[model samples]
Target chain A: MKRLTRSAQRALDRYLHTLRTCLTGSNAIDAHEVEHDVLGHIEQELSECREPIAWARLQIVLDRLGSPLMWVPEHDLPSWKQLLLRLRIGPEDWRLAYASFALWMLAVVALLAAYEPIALGALLGSFVTARAARAFGGELDQSDRSKRWLTEPALATAALVLGGAVLLSVLPAMALVSRELVEIDTLRLQFPSVYHISQRLVAVFERPVSWGWIRSALLHGGPWLLLPLGAWWLVLGGIARWRPRWFAITFSPGRPNCAARVGRLLMIAGALVIGTGVAIGLVKTLSIAI
Target chain B: MKPRKDLRPEKWTTQLRKGVLELCVLNVIATGRLYGYEIAKRLSALSEPTVREGTVYPILSRLKQEGLLEATIEASSEGPPRKYFALTAHGRRRLRHMNAAWDLLDDNLKTLRRRTAP
Candidate 1:
């Protein structure tokens, strides 16, 4: 067998890279198996030719093999996998949707574990879900118009409910559980020194406070916390309905306009300011009551 | 007058080709054990709408997974080891049934064409 020329090898590498991209996330065949088979086929063809194969000749052979996208057998996928694939935001970008959903779930778990913030988890979850829903909406646009209102709105509503549950319910429940684990008598007895230190710290920070005010504030303020997020979801859903491109632009920072960039920066700053204010209020209220 | 954009022939041919491609692939392998490129080359040579080598690998992989075909990696003098695919016992039985079905379909189609001839 004769070795390929340097230029030919480089061209083959680039071709294989594009082929690999097209074959990614394919469930029908192992990517490595296909790559190995393709490489073997190419080498077999190359070996039959004279020594020092020309780069153009190699390209011609690759072209004859056709685009790698042609080899992605969608029918080979199981029904459930196909359904999940349809949940994507773009053509051939189902992998992004899957990755984002996986990350969103991980962020949700972290929030429930009390290892992350409610706001952060809510933001991540809503962002990814919105992106995925946007992709689904795009597909819906090209599909039957009769089903558009039903499916797209339903998806947005589900996302909003999930975001609210994650923020209001899961985060608070986990925080309560974490607080109880620390405050429990049996656990406190097991860590007497730690408990004593915590008590001393609490005593130092303690201030006189009425329990009624805190209770009433929580009863009133808890529901209000969801207002900003609910409004955001409504606005997002409205944009997604009327102008999907605008919805896409709002979330996708890769090709953002100058206005979007500035808006995103301002939103981040506002979130930080609000988050800090909430943290301070919570600390002050808890110090007085606990 | 605008030319009629009749697409039924192309569409029907595409569907027909897809339907028979697997059966054709099985028949090709039944002749002898063949590597990926060999199978593709033989099929493209024998059939319409030439089968590219890349298209052959997935079908080969699917057949192998379905227990209709099995592959073995053999060391090659040229480059990487070649995965040679051959029919399993089940595959032979499937090929027999598929061949019988094809013959029946072919006979019926021939009779229909003869009857309809002007």
Candidate 2:
């Protein structure tokens, strides 16, 4: 690149800065891509310049480029509406980010609308679009204030969904694979699948499994569920510990470094839960067997 | 200011240029793959009134996003790699339609101007 006079460089910087500022929030454009193109254009235009290109010479090029403000002429909307319009229009990733937010908002509306199917569909859509936005943004952990506001709810829900499923199902999963103790089916909920899974869990260790095993496992399994559920809490704590900013963005908002302390406490609690669960499982097995 | 309600001829002309600039860009790329600067320069020379130099970059970005145009980067000795844009098959079709429309509009405007001339 040809060296530029100090004034020329400053002029170029201001121009590019203004261009980026104008472009950054446009929904129809990727600001960075345009910035790169602008730079390339300048490089080509200045290729044959003197050893140190002067501001006057550079000004001519910038003049031809026109004022950056002209590219994004202000709209005629009312002040409040114009503010909303500003948020609505932004760089390309922001479109997906806003779409995800809109879907998330719709999911909330569906919740109030008392519609389960629609709520689930919108939640799923929000989750997908949020992930797409994150992927498109090219940052796995991007948490720009604008972007996170648009995406965090969906991402948080995703964490909750996956974490909830795994945590809830782990005990039954463990029961299937682990030794049986005092199997007594209590706390009857009318879930037919629960009944079937319960019966199968009971006889699972004895013979070819039947739904009877579920009944037996249910008796001793209630306390044991804590083990895996607690471990999941610890897993999030670990994330909070390592990437506290990401933890704050995705999970909860708190002061800096709080994730570490919070995560440590969760791990300790999880360890205690695991210990208690194992001891209870072992003691119950012995007491019931004897 | 209410832009659509504004009756300034300059403002109208600017809007008109923005609309046609896309057509002009595709036409430029239709000829051959050209780098960003080169494309902007070619269109900007249409006297910078029809197309501002900086504006071409945004248009290129949009066209590429829309899949009408695609970009390739090649190494350069002076600065960063040059981003060369070319028309996709879809772009070619769109350009052909735009060109036909422009021609029809031009002929009608000419006829109208002739009829109204004192």
- In terms of DockQ, the best-performing candidate is 2
| Model 2 CAPRI rating | acceptable
True contacts kept of each: 0.55, 0.64
Binned by DockQ into CAPRI classes (incorrect, acceptable, medium, high), candidate 1 is acceptable
Determine the TM-score of chain B of model 2.
0.87
> Candidate 1, residues A1-290: lDDT per residue as tens digits?
35677656765775676566555566656667777788877877787788788766787788677666566555665666456545532244344444445555555666677876753655465455545544443322222234333333333444466534533453244334444555778768898754554443333223233676445433433323333434444444444455545644543322234334434543454455456446655776787798
| lDDT tens digits, residue span B1-118, model 1 | 7544445676556556666878989999999988998998887677654445567776787788789999998987766778889999999999999999999999999999999999
Q: Where in model 2 is the C-alpha error above 4 Å?
A: A72-290, B1-6, B48-50, B77-79
TM, every model? 0.44, 0.45
Error of 2 at A82 (Å): 5.9
